[model samples]
Target: MSDTEAHPVRISSHPAQLQALEPVLKKVRTRVGDIPALLALAEDIGHAAPKPGEGSTAKLWELLASVTAVDVAAGRALEPHLDAVAILAQAGVEESKPGAWGVFAAEGPGLKLEAKRQADGNVVLNGSKPWCSLASRLDGAVITAYTEDNGRAAFAVNLNDPGVSCETPLWTSRGLREIPSGTVHFDQVPATPVGGAAWYFERPGFAWGGMGVAACWLGGTVAVARDFRTALAKAAENGREPDQIALAHLGEVDRIIASVTAYLAQTAEWIDAGSSADSSNAWSEALRVRATVAAAVERVQTVVTQNLGPAPLAFNEAYGKRMADLSLYVRQHHGMRDDAQLGALALKGDRRW
Candidate 1:
C-alpha cells in the first residue's frame, strides 16, 4: 500500500454500527482526562455496541477496535463495561439500573473474597478483591467470589453500597492513567448472583470477552501504524521520497495489520456461528487469537519506532501515549504463559489442524 492509502483497515462489516459509534467516540476524545465524562461515554457506547454471540460478534469487536483507535484509555474503561453487559444478558439478569458496569474477576494471592448466603436467600460479600478497575467510578460491577461450598460464582453488586470501599491512589501505571485499577474491599456488601458455580469461566462469553481485549490491542496498534504512515505521507508531500528501508517497514506493518484483522474477523465469525459453544474450543480460539494479535502489535510497534526513530516519541504526544498504553495493555495477554496453556490444551487433543 502507498503512504496515502496505508491507514488501518476497517474490520467491521457493519457500516451502520460504525456510523452510530462515531459521535460517541468523538465525545470520548474530548473527555480525555475526565473520568466521569469518560464513564458516561462508555454508557453511550454500551447502548450502541452489539452484545457478543448474538450474530454480530465481529461487529462487537469492530466497535471495540474503533474505540481503542480513538483513545486507548477510553477503550480501557469501556471494554469491561461492555463485557459486563454481555455477561448480564447471558445470565438472563435484567440490569436493575442503567449505569456503567465493570467486571472484577481477577484473583490475587492475598485474602479471597467470600460469599455468605443469608437466611433470606440473599448473598453478602466480604474480604478484598484485587484488580477492580474503575471500581470507584463505576456504578456497579460483576464480581467473582468463593461460596460456602468452596465453589466460585459471579455476583452483581452496587459500588455505591456503604460497605464497599476502593483503595485509591494504588494503581501507579503511567499508561492508561485515567483508568486506575485497585483493590476493593467489601464489608458485608450485599450482591445479586449472576451465574451458578463455575459458570462464569465455563461460559463461552468468557473467552469472547478475553478476545474483546485483543481487539483493543489491535486498534491501538493500528493507531500507532497510522502515525508512521502520516509521517511518511508528510515527507512525500514535502518532495522527499522515503528510502527503501522505510518502504520495507511500511510493507511489514501493512502485512501485520491485515493478518491480525483477518484473524479477529474470522474468530468473531466463528463465535457467532456457535463454533465456540464448546468451552474448550472457545478458550482455545481466544488464546490463539490473543497471542497472535499481541505479537503482531509488538511487531508493528517495533517497526514504527524503528522507522520513525525517537522524534515522534519525544515530540508527538498522541504517538507516545498510544505506544505506552498499547505496550501495557497488550501485556494482559500473559505472553509465554498463555502459550504454555495453549500447549497443554494441545496435548489433550485440542488440536484443530
Candidate 2:
C-alpha cells in the first residue's frame, strides 16, 4: 500500500461503512489535537441514528471499531461522547442548542457528585465525579446525581456553567493517556433534568452503546493482529520462506477473528432489529458479546505479542501505543463475572440458543 493509502483501516469486514470515515480519519491525522475538527467530523458522519429506529447503527459501531484499530486512544476518547449522546437522545434529552456531550454516572457510595434541589425547584450539582472523559473539553454532560426527592436521577449540565470545575488531566498511564478522564467537581452547577429518575440506565440504547465499545476493542485487536501479519510479511519479502510455526499461528488467529466477527454480525443484527430494546434479551446479549469480543481481543493481543517478541514494542512507536491503548481499553470488559451473571440470567430467563 502507498504511504497515503496505508493508514486507512479497511481491515475489518465493513469496508462500505468505512468509506465515509476515511476523510474523517485523514482530517484527524493532519489536524491532530484539534477537538473542533473531530466534532465536525462526527457531525458530518451524522448522528448515529437521527431517530430511534433509524440510520445505520451497525455501521456506526463498525466505524468506531475501525477508528480504534487505527488509534485506540483517540477512539476511546471519542466513543463515550458519541455513545452518551445517543443514550441521552433516546431518553428524550434533546440538545436544542449545539455542543459536545458526555455522561458522568459511575454510581456508588463514596462516588460523590450529588444533585440538590433548591426551593425554587432548580437543580444544583455539587461534589466530585470520577471517570469523566473529556471533562475539560465537553460542552455539556448527562450527569447522574443523588437528589433528596428522587434519590438517584439523571441531569444534564452545561460544562461552561460557572459552577462546574474539572480537575487537571491527571491520567498517567501510557495507554489511553490521550483521553483526559479525571475528576469533575460540580459546585452548585445548575442543570436541566434529562429524563425521569433512572431513565439513563433504563434506556435500551445504553446497552447498544456498550456494545459499540466492544466493537472498538475488536478494531484495536485487529490492529494488533496486523502487527503479527506484518512481521510475517517482512520475512517473506526479505527472501525468507515463512516458517510453518508462524504460518500455523496465523491460521489460528484467522479462525478466532472469523469466529468473533460472526458473533459481532449476529449481535449487530439483534441491535438493528431493536431486539436490544427488550431488556432481557439486551442485557443477556450485551454481556455475551462483551465477554466474547473481549476474550478474542485479548487472545489476539497475547498470541501476537508472544510470537512477535519485543521488536514491535521497542522499534515501532505507533504499534507500541496501539498495544498499550488496546490493553487498557479491553479492560472495560468484566471477564468471568460478566459471563457468570449472563449465564445466571440466561438460566433464569430460560433464554434458549
Candidate 3:
C-alpha cells in the first residue's frame, strides 16, 4: 500500500469506553498547531491535557483496565500510565512553571493545612493549584509531599477554600497567548495522605508514569509534523518547492518520531506482560522516551523557524503561538537533561526503576 493508505491513523470510536475522547484527540491536533499553544497547554494543564482514556497512575488505572479492550482494538492498548508516585510528583512540580502547583518546589516542605480530619480520617485540601487543568479549574488536587520518613506521601487538595487563590492570566507567548497558564496560591491548605514512601519509588505505577509522559510528548511532535506538512503542501500549490532545508528538517523529525514510537510500544508491551516490572526498565525507558520527545519538539522549532522564516513569526499567529508554546513545553520535565545518564543506567541494568 502507499504511505497514505498504510498510515491512516484515526481516533478510536469507542464512545462509551473513551468518554468522548475522539474530540479531545482532535482538539489536541488543533490546539497544538505549533509550539506556543503547546507550551500554553503544558503550562495550563501541567502535562498535555489528560485525554479521556489516560490515567493518573492510581485513580485512573481501574478505568484503564475497564477500557483495555477498547485500547487493544484501537491500537492504543500499550500506552500505560506512568508511575503513580512520579506522575504525582511531576504533576505537582515539574510539568509547568507559573501555574498554581508550579510553586510547590520553590516553597519547600512542611506546610500546614486548613481543614480538619475527615470522616475517614482523611483531610480536605483548601489551596488553589493555580494552573491545574482539572483540579485547579474544579478546586482540589491529589497532592503529595515529604513525610517524616523523608519520603513522599500523597493527598488531595481542595481549590474552593476561602484561602485558595488563583490568578487566571495567560503567559506572554506570541503563539499560545490565550491559554490560562496563570499562578495559584494556597494558605493553610488541608490535605490527607493516601500512600506512604513506597508509593514514591517502589510501586508498580512508576513504569506506567514513565510511559504516559512519553505518550504526551509523542502527540505534540506529531502535531508539529502535521503543521509542517500543511505548510509544505501550500508552498507546492504556489509553484514553489519547500525550501531544501525544511525538507531535511522534516526527515529528521520523522526519524525521531518513528524511533520513539517503536521504543514506547516495546516498553508498553513489557509492562503489559506483568513480569517485566524491574525499576531499571521503568526509569531507563521513561528517560529515553522523554529525551526523544524533547529532541523531536526541538527539531520542529528549528525546522519551522528556518523554513517559515520571519514572515510566519510575525504574520502567522497560529504558527507563531505553537512555536513559542513548544519552546517552553519541551523544558517542563525534571531531570530530562540527564536522559543520557538514565539511558546509560538502563543499558547497564544497574539502576532501580
Candidate 4:
C-alpha cells in the first residue's frame, strides 16, 4: 500500500466478551505476518480511526486484555501497538503517542503530547511523536493536544486522515523489521476527546499505564528464548560444533527470563492489590523489572546473533525481524536506570527523603 492510502485494520468491538474475541485473537496470532504494515498504520494514524467493530469501550479493553493474555498464552509478545493503545486509554487522555521512550516503561510525567481543539469543539493536532511503535500500519491514534481551555486533552484520530502522516525514517536496531518505529506528524487532524483535563492523569489506571511495557518486554524475552532453544536443538541434530560461550549466554538468557516472569507476576499482584500507589515500592519494583528485562533481552540477542552466524541478521526474515524487534522493544526500559532512587525513597517512609 502507498503512504497515502489508509492501511485498514479494524479492531473487534465485542473484544471483552471472551467468546466473541477468541476468533479474532486466533486470527491475530496466525495472520500477523506483516507487522511493519500494522505499525505504520498505528504510528501514522491512530488506534481509534476506523472505530473497532466492537464499539463498546469495555469491549475494546476486553480486546486489549485478551491480546495481552493471549500473548502470554501463546508464548508470543503482546505487540507494542496494543500496549500503547491501552496506556493511552487508561490515562484518560484524548490522544497519546504510544512510542515515546519512557512513556510506557517508567515513572514521572509521561510523554508530552499536544492536541488542539477548535472553537467548534473540533480538535486539530500538530506535533511530532517519537517511538510510535507500529506507526506505519495503525488505522487510528489517540493523541494528546492542547486546547483553548489551556488544558491537555486526549483523543483518537484516524491516520488515513489528511492531517496525519508517518515517516519511517529509521527502523529500530533489534534485527526485527516488523515494528517500524518512527515519527508521526499530525497537522490539523480531527479528533475526539477521551475525557477531561484532570482525567488525563487523574484516572485510576494512570499509574499502571506505564507498566504495560514491562509485560511487552517480558513477551519479547520469551520469544527470544523459544527461538534460541529451537536453534540449539537444530544444531545438536546436525552434530555441528557448538559454541560453549554461546551456550553459556543462552543459559543466562533463560535465567533472566525466569526472573523477569517472577518480577512481573509480583508486579501484577501488587497492581491488583492497589499497592502501586506507593511510589516507593511501585517504582522500585518497576525499576527492577526494567533492569531484568534489559539484561535478558541483551543476552538473548547476543546468543541468537552468535549462533545464527550473521546469516539470520542479514537474511532470515522471521528470526532477523524478531531480533531487531526485541532490540528496539527493550530500549523502553531505560527508565529503570533510577531503580536505586526508588529504593532510597522506599527507605524514607513518608519522611521525604
Candidate 5:
C-alpha cells in the first residue's frame, strides 16, 4: 500500500480546542505585556490543561500549541507551571496552594542549591539557583537541589518564603522580553521533597514535559507560517501571482509543519500507550522530537523571513515578535549537545530500530 493509503489524514482536534480558547486567547494577544497578568493566565491554564500520560497526551500538547500559536511568551510562562503540576501529580503530592508555579532545574558552575535534611525530618534549601524564569512572580516552584550525597533531587518550595530572594538578571533579549529568567537565592527555605534522589530526571514525565515545550516551538512556527500564507494570499488577490521562489518556500514550510505534526501525534500516542515509560526510550523519543521540532522552527523562520522580506518584520508587530520568540525559544534544545547525547545512547545499544 502507498503511504497515503496506509495513513489517512484525520481531522485535528487543534481547531476545536483553539476555538474554545478564542476568547481567552483574544485577551492574551493584547494584555500579554505584564508578569502579573501572565501569571494569572498561567494559573487558569494550569487548572484546565491536561496532564501527560493520561490517555489524552495529544490533547494536552495540542492545547499547548494552541496557546503558543497566540503568543509565544504566554506559552513560555504557562508551560513550566503546567509541568510543575504534572510533576506533583506524578509524584503523588497534593498541590499545597492555588497559585502559579515554575520549574527551576538549570544549574550553573558556581551557583548551587543544597537540600539539607533537618532534624525535624524536613528539607531546607540553601544557596542560589540559575535560570529560574518568573521566579519573583510565581507563587511556588519545583526546584532541583543537590542532596547530601551530592545527588540532585526535586523539591517543592514556596517562592513567597522570606528566605527566598529573586535576583533579576539584566535580560536584554528582544524575544520573550516579557519573561525575564533570573537567579533565585534560598537561605534556609523550607521545602517538601517531591521524590527521591534522581527521580526528577529519571521519571518518564521529565521527557514528556520536555516534548511539551517542543509543541510550543511548533506552534510558534505555525504562526509564522500563517503570516507567509497570508502574504501570498494578499498578493494573489491584488492580481500578482506568487513567483516560483515563494511557492517553493511555502512548499517547504508545509512539509516541515506536516512532519512535526505527525511526529508529535505518534509520540503522544506512544506516551499514552505506556510505551515511553522506560527512561531510556522516553529520553530517546523526547530528544528526537525536540531536535526535529527545533530544526523545523529554524527552517521555517528562515524561509518565512526570506519570502516575506524585511517589510513585515519592520512594520508588523505580531509577526516580528513571533519570529523573535521562536528564534530564542527553540534554542533550549541545546543544538549539538543534545544530539551527542542521543548518539551516545545509540552507541550504547539503546536502539529502537
Candidate 6:
C-alpha cells in the first residue's frame, strides 16, 4: 500500500476492540517516531493500556493485536518496554518524567545489578543485565538490582547516562532481527528508587504485565493462523480443491483460533473486574492463563505447520517469519519450568492461586 493509502492494521476481531485501539492508530498515521508505529501507538496510550486501576482488558488486547499485526517479533520487544512504563506508573516511580520513554526491566536473578546508596541517599546501580531488549535505544529502564543490604530492589536507570552501556544486540540466531535485544552493563549509574526491596515482583502489576505478554503470544499465533487461512483461500482460488484431510486440518485451525479468542476475552473481563487485586493470587492466575494460552499457541503452531505442510515455511516469506518469530517468542514462557512453577504456586499455599 502507498503511504497515503495504508490503513491501520485490521487485526482486531470486534468493534469494541477496534474502538479501544483507534486513538493510538490515528496518532501512528500522522507522526514520525523512533519506535515502530505500533509501539508509538502504545507509548501514546501509556497507562491507558488496561492494567490494575487502568483501562479494561479489551483495550489492552487491542494494543497487542495491532502490535502483532505490525510484526510478531517486534511486539515482544514492545511488551517489556510498555510493561516497565506501566509498572513505574503503577508504583508512582518517575511520575513526572514525560515523552515517549521506554524501559526494559530484565532483572530476574543471575548476573545481578547491585544498588548502592550514596551519601545523599540517592541510588546508583552497578552490574550486568542480560536480555535487555531495546536497551541501546530506550530512554530509560526500571531494573532489579541487589542492594547493599543483600535484598532485591528496583532502580529506575536512564540509558542516556554515561554509566550505562548496552551490548550489541546479537539475536540473529533466533528470529527477532528488528529488535536490538541484548545485554547491558551498568557502572555506578544514577537512578531513582521505584520502591523498597522486592517491590518489582511483589506488585500486582507484575502478573498483569505477564498476562500482557501472553496477549502478545496470542496475537502472534493469530497471525500464524491467518497464514493458514490465506493458504486455504489460495487453494480455492487456484481451483485446487482441498482433500478431506486438508479440510479437516483447516477446521482444526479454526477451532483452536476460536478457543484462544474466547479465553482472551475471559481473561480481559477478569482483569477489568480487578480479580488481580491480590498480588499472590494474581501471580498464580497469570501463570495459569499464560500456561493455558501458551499451550493454545503451541497447538495453533502445530496445526498450522502440519496442515500446510513444508511449502509455506520454505516458500512464503511472511509465513516463515511469523513461524520463526513466534517459535522463539513463546519459548520466553519456557516449556516445562513454567508449568512446574505453576504447580508449585498452586499447591504451596491456599492463598497462592
| Candidate 5 Cα lDDT to native | 0.85
Worst 10 residues of 2 by lDDT: 2-11
**Between candidates 2 and 5, the TM-score winner:** 5
| CA lDDT of every candidate | 0.86, 0.73, 0.47, 0.52, 0.85, 0.70
User: lDDT tens string, model 2, 285-329?
Assistant: 778778988988888887888888898888988778888888888
Which candidate should be chosen as best, given TM-score against the real structure?
1
Model 6 over residues 1-353: C-alpha lDDT tens digits?
32111222232346544654555545543532235554555566665555443646656665765566446765665676677777777777764444445555565556787889999988888888888776665676777878888987777777888988888964666466666567789888898888778888897778887888888887777667667767777788899878788788778877776776676676667766877688887787778878877887898888878888898789977677778887787887876897788778767873432
For model 5, how many clashes?
0
**What's the TM-score of each model vs. the native?**
0.95, 0.90, 0.63, 0.63, 0.94, 0.86
- State model 6's lDDT: 0.70
- Per-residue lDDT of 1-353 in model 4, one digit per residue for the tens? 11101111112232243465455555545535545432443343334422221124223333333443323322122334454455454544444333311121111234344666578867677666666645555555555556656676556666677876778766534443444456677777776666676465544344344454555555555655666776777778899755787678778776776666556555565565665555445555556656766776677777667766877667866556556555665566664446666556667763324
Q: RMSD per prediction, one decimal?
A: 2.5, 2.7, 9.2, 9.1, 4.9, 3.8
Poorest 10 consecutive residues of model 3 by lDDT?
Answer: 69-78
- Give the alpha carbon lDDT tens digit for every residue of 172-264 in model 5: 998988888899999999999998889999999999999999988887888787778888988999999899999999999998898889989
Summarize candidate 3's per-residue lDDT along 195-273 as a digit string, tens digits.
Answer: 4544545544554554454454455455556667777888899999977777887787777666765665555555556
Better of 4 and 6 by lDDT: 6
RMSD score of candidate 2 (Å): 2.7
**Residue by residue across 298-331, what tens digits does model 1's lDDT show?**
9999999988999989997877888888888898
For candidate 1, give the lDDT: 0.86
TM-score of 4: 0.63
Clash count for each candidate, listed in order shown: 0, 0, 32, 46, 0, 0
